[model samples]
Target: MGLDAFVYCRCWQDGLTPPAPVGPVGFDEEGYLSLVVSGGGYTETDAAFDGWTASACPHELMEQASEHLSNWTGHRLFQQALGAAGWSHFPALQAELPSANGGRMPAEAAVRVLDELDYFEQQAVIDDEVVLVDEATEAVALRYVAAYEGVLMLGPGYRAGVDPEGFFILDPDSDPPATLFRSARFRQRVLPSGQVQFSDEKKSVQIAMSPVGDKGTPPEWLRLEKQHQAPAEFGYIVEPLRRLCRAAVATGNPVMWC
Candidate 1:
């Protein structure tokens, strides 16, 4: 069996308790404004919840959205390009060129060329290499090799600031406002038996409204959307959840996943 994921928003009140796991529930387009259990339970039952609710988005949808969002929102365009070239998987390339230091030119030299040139300009230098497979794959491999070399230049902490959390938060009222989009806060919990769970405690959950396109959206995120050619192709999947978030925020309710 695969891991289950859920996304819902509940109204906030001073003494309200968290929603109990009554069983499986489905949310529709209008948002699950009222909680209804199949076994004939009152809307105010301890197990049921009030306020806006959206159908739970699939875990895979969240994962894909996060990946695309990262790629589009990140300022490191070169690194993104390198990733497209498969740099993380294959870092070395076979080429026939002499090194400036003396023997055959190593992968390091190819990387330097990549950093110094734009996409089109790098093609001239790459043309001299021995055919690795096909022209397209070889070109991508060469770029990856270059990216690896560039990372080496940054020293040990090149990746130190990378966010380990997997989800992005979108709070608009933050001090700087833009700070909300800076890092991911969603994290995975590892069980003693080595099983992994993608869930968070109520206290740890951060507040964020969905990026459903509005004037309230942060400028930085809007630019990313334009730059990446509307990278949020899967936005529809999260629309309901976004609506739920809006309702929760309006009612001062907390959103949680189980």
Candidate 2:
């Protein structure tokens, strides 16, 4: 089985845009000859969707009627509520959230976090530790540990929607502690069962993570793992990706956890 996807590209831009596709994350549009480098594998089609989104596109366009007219007060409240609802998704890092981040959160809270990004000012940084803060509430939403070379795929549920509306990216003050990047070292050992594992003694934990949207989305990277197992292999890569596509459509939500 294999994955099929369209890559978006934009012309006339320089450098990696904020939230650059350093890994398998998806983009919202597709074009050819992008001015910026898109992280995912690309096809020969003269199209790419990996770049900084423009105001003209529906994905980046903000509704003027959104309740966040003045500052990010309204949106901030929403983000906090959402974070609370999704708290269970982030493990080992939950307690570290409130003080280091914002505070302890419940899995089902109504607090919406960063619902409208326009109210918040944004900046770009490379290979640095950045903090995600809700400007209105002064809450630290999340932290990103980046590599000077590129980004690593972020955790699931960091992005939980099809519109790519609720995601935020933050760089850390320094490289993430050793435990974060530890997983990459073991990637070289692809086991016979196709399952991979990382060992603390053999790997450093300092990893770079980027929040990516749902799978099967148009512009994100769709990795085709087992090309020869499509029709007959029930548990093959093709069926799994197809299942992801169907799930995305049925839910009307991006497979945000991918």
Candidate 3:
């Protein structure tokens, strides 16, 4: 029901085998290594796609980057990069989209979010306390709190997206008081059913309330055993997808994110 990625490569011609999933959420550690870490799951071959190829090359690429990247890419450079990619599939993604990601293709919005990656960061809400160790990471988290001050992920949509963890990355001044609710203590909880619940219980009754994105909280990091430093903006998502695109170009294969 959620998004996953794959590489439709001719390399899978020999004997396509999708990385076996050990759990419903994802595959085992080794599967992640091949499917995502290296972005290479099959041996390269000169052979072309034939009657033997699997739709996904039996290996995944990304787990959903969310719709953030492409929608945020209303910026200049990302549009340029897509046009330059020489892949019409990418260029078409830049066209006016529908309701999913503010009139942008899911993939295209992903590109924009990741365009200014140097500014992105990743933080986690441990036990429901947005906790991050590094200076930059903490700064971004603090910025979202409005009580403190962040975003490469900043903009009109800033408040709607960031919680303690969503952006730990949007510029601090974007719309703080509204972005992170009223305080760091306002926790976002993930139930065993994998559903998210963000407590809007304000840190201060005096502070006015703003709406939160229904699916803003990152669904995966809820169980993080340790603080994960994704540093700066939405770059974490952008970089992986960019790599996939590069891989696609280099191998003349198709990039599949669904």
Candidate 4:
């Protein structure tokens, strides 16, 4: 996920000492170079470039740079990668609920989305629940969340299955369903009978991949920021909060939302 190269600050078009590569540069499908940099840390833009009078850099610049890099490549590597990884464009299952926005989403339209996904992937039952898998999962999931405004779910007893079409959609209602994808886009499909099914030309076995790998626990400092609200009073701890913020900024991943 990290890039194999680096670029210096002196080459930043401004006459200033550049900051070191804070993280590895990652390649999108188009091969554009990208790396995370400390926005608040000293950079070429900081006056004096880290001298006694240097001003702290702003964190927003890192975001700006990331956006720039995405276009710089002009290649959809990020998107391609996700698709290659078999991610969904949005979570595929929803609970039966009224459309709060008062807009009705026809079931046929939802089925069409599934139909398109069918040609690209496979479906299988993992731990006794059905799910979809394919090369496009990662790309699909990434864009799906961003485009559809969705969240990832985790837990036991979640069923994974092919969403009627060849695409993957987690059916939470199935016995032993491992996860359920909830999104506004799928809200209209939630019917009072809770019966949802689509047609697919093919079905096959699937393998699910978790971004969080099977591994040891992260350091306490890393954990603090990664799971900010988990323990509840994360912000009240000044030193930890400062350290986490500094760490995020330093790594080009400042917790702006947090």
Candidate 5:
């Protein structure tokens, strides 16, 4: 059986004992957070969560929120840019810079570089390693990315043109307001089992699309077209969840995912 997850929030005043575990873990109609799992579960009582006020986010929701923030920040692109700028390995640079105080680079310049490096590193980790996002999280991220990209397709100047080799290309240059250019870079190939596989490699990943009429648009693009008309609704759900994670972190609350 699959594991079900829940998010919760807890707060206590001075001289008052922390709230005892009550109902199951879940969101109730009255906006209360509970922990009553069908099979029963225990809430973590880490000292980090013992603050005067705190919120905990579910693992799945946290991953989804992270995906949203990553896209918004163009984190992957930023990392690639960092590499191009001669930062061989960002994490290594981050660690070494703090200790290499005797180097030729001035302390102030090093600090500035460290600050910018830290931002990228934090965005890359997003409070934790993304590898923690299991298959379940991957499924959610794929669907959300697809739907988000679809909604972007409805904007003016979004032209769906086929590359000469029948590969689909969403030309953002044609669409002035298109921030979804990265979405177009993803290529999809339908396996014989009808399952769609996605990749970003244009040359390494073989395209299974036949060079017939329409040049075979990736199903992902079609999904995006279907979603393009309802971008706001999509954002409404994802944005708040992202903010919840941010708020939880801001309050020094550690997000626990099962």
Candidate 6:
């Protein structure tokens, strides 16, 4: 399913005190913001900001955004890119990033990583309005922007086994089911059979797998990793997201995934 992200400010609405909105946090029945209107139950966005549009609104764009993203938001590729950049802090301590679409990034920290994202924003972010067409998919970044919604987290992962000539040709069994994720902390869960997952961007990524041939009809696993290897395409995700984080920062709220 697609992710529905919004900011939360625990104790902002209720009388309780707001805790440290950043760093490692485990899942809970009562999320950080238990009774806040922005806690994914209310349909109205706090009127304090304009950049953020709730996925529940009546606008058609938001309707589309409920299941998709646009030039303004971060999608899977962008999330993966952020993960690759934050890999240096993996294993011992998860980076503040919530690589997949679930979890929250305290507005303060999400935008604070603007330092981590500035280079990506400059080099990788997609122009939210007009990128280009991939002859194969018709629209590489276009359809993505249309997807303003997408995430689930992946736990620790491993490297892909490739062919003799060392090209990432699709492996129906493994590659088809594989994808990447970066998170604030690894979750403990039973992964269903037939899927492949991993971490360690420095050690496991196919950094030089296909310098140029990353295009064409590549599988999900290859495409995300290719974005990992290249810098130019990472922007498709950060444009909307960084803007959202900036908006959240302005509002002093926590970003939440519904």
RMSD, one per candidate, in order: 25.0, 23.3, 16.1, 21.2, 17.2, 15.2
Residue lDDT tens for model 3, 1-258: 222344334333333444333212222232321322222443332122221222334333232222223433222223333333333443334442222312112333434433433222232111222332223223222222222332323344333333344332232455444334333334444556543344534432211222222235432222111233223233534555566544544444444543
lDDT (Cα, 0-100) at 137 in candidate 6: 46
The segments of candidate 4 whose C-alpha lies over 4 angstroms from its true place after superposition are 1-8, 11-15, 18-64, 68-152, 160-258
**What's model 5's TM-score?**
0.24
Query: Quick one: best TM-score, which candidate?
Result: 6
Q: lDDT per prediction? A: 0.27, 0.26, 0.33, 0.27, 0.31, 0.37
Compose the digit string of candidate 6's lDDT tens values, residues 148-204: 222111123432222111212222247555433332111112124433333233323
Give the runs in model 5 whose Cα sits over 4 Å from its true position: 1-67, 71-74, 88-114, 117-250, 254-258
- lDDT: worst 10-residue window of model 2: 62-71
Return whichever of 1 and 2 wins on TM-score.
1
Query: Model 4: number of clashes?
Result: 35
For all candidates, the clash counts are 5, 53, 26, 35, 11, 24
Query: 175-231, model 1: which lDDT tens digit per residue?
Result: 543333222222333345533233233323222222212223212111111112121
Candidate 2 segments exceeding 4 Å error: 1-118, 122-186, 199-258
- Ranked by TM-score, the better of candidates 3 and 6 is 6
Off by over 4 Å in 3: 1-3, 12-234
Residue by residue across 1-258, what tens digits does model 5's lDDT show?
111112233332122334434432343343333333433343353223323224333233222222122343233323334444446435443332222112222223333444444444344322111110112122112222221332222223333322212223243454344322233335455677643354554332332223112234333322222111222222432343344344434433322222
Off by over 4 Å in 1: 1-229
Q: Give residue 156's error in model 1 in angstroms.
A: 34
Q: Candidate 6 versus the native: TM-score? A: 0.37
User: Of models 2 and 3, which has the larger lDDT?
Assistant: 3
Model 6 whole-model lDDT (C-alpha atoms) = 0.37
- lDDT per residue for candidate 2 within 1-258, as digits (tens), equals 111222122212323345423333333333222334443566432133333344323433211111111112222322233243343442322332222211222222211211111111122111222333333333333333221122223343221111111122223433552222222112212234532222334442222333222222212121111111111211222233234334334323322211
Model 3 lDDT-worst window of ten: 45-54
RMSD in Å for model 6: 15.2
**Candidate ranking (lDDT, best to worst):** 6, 3, 5, 1, 4, 2
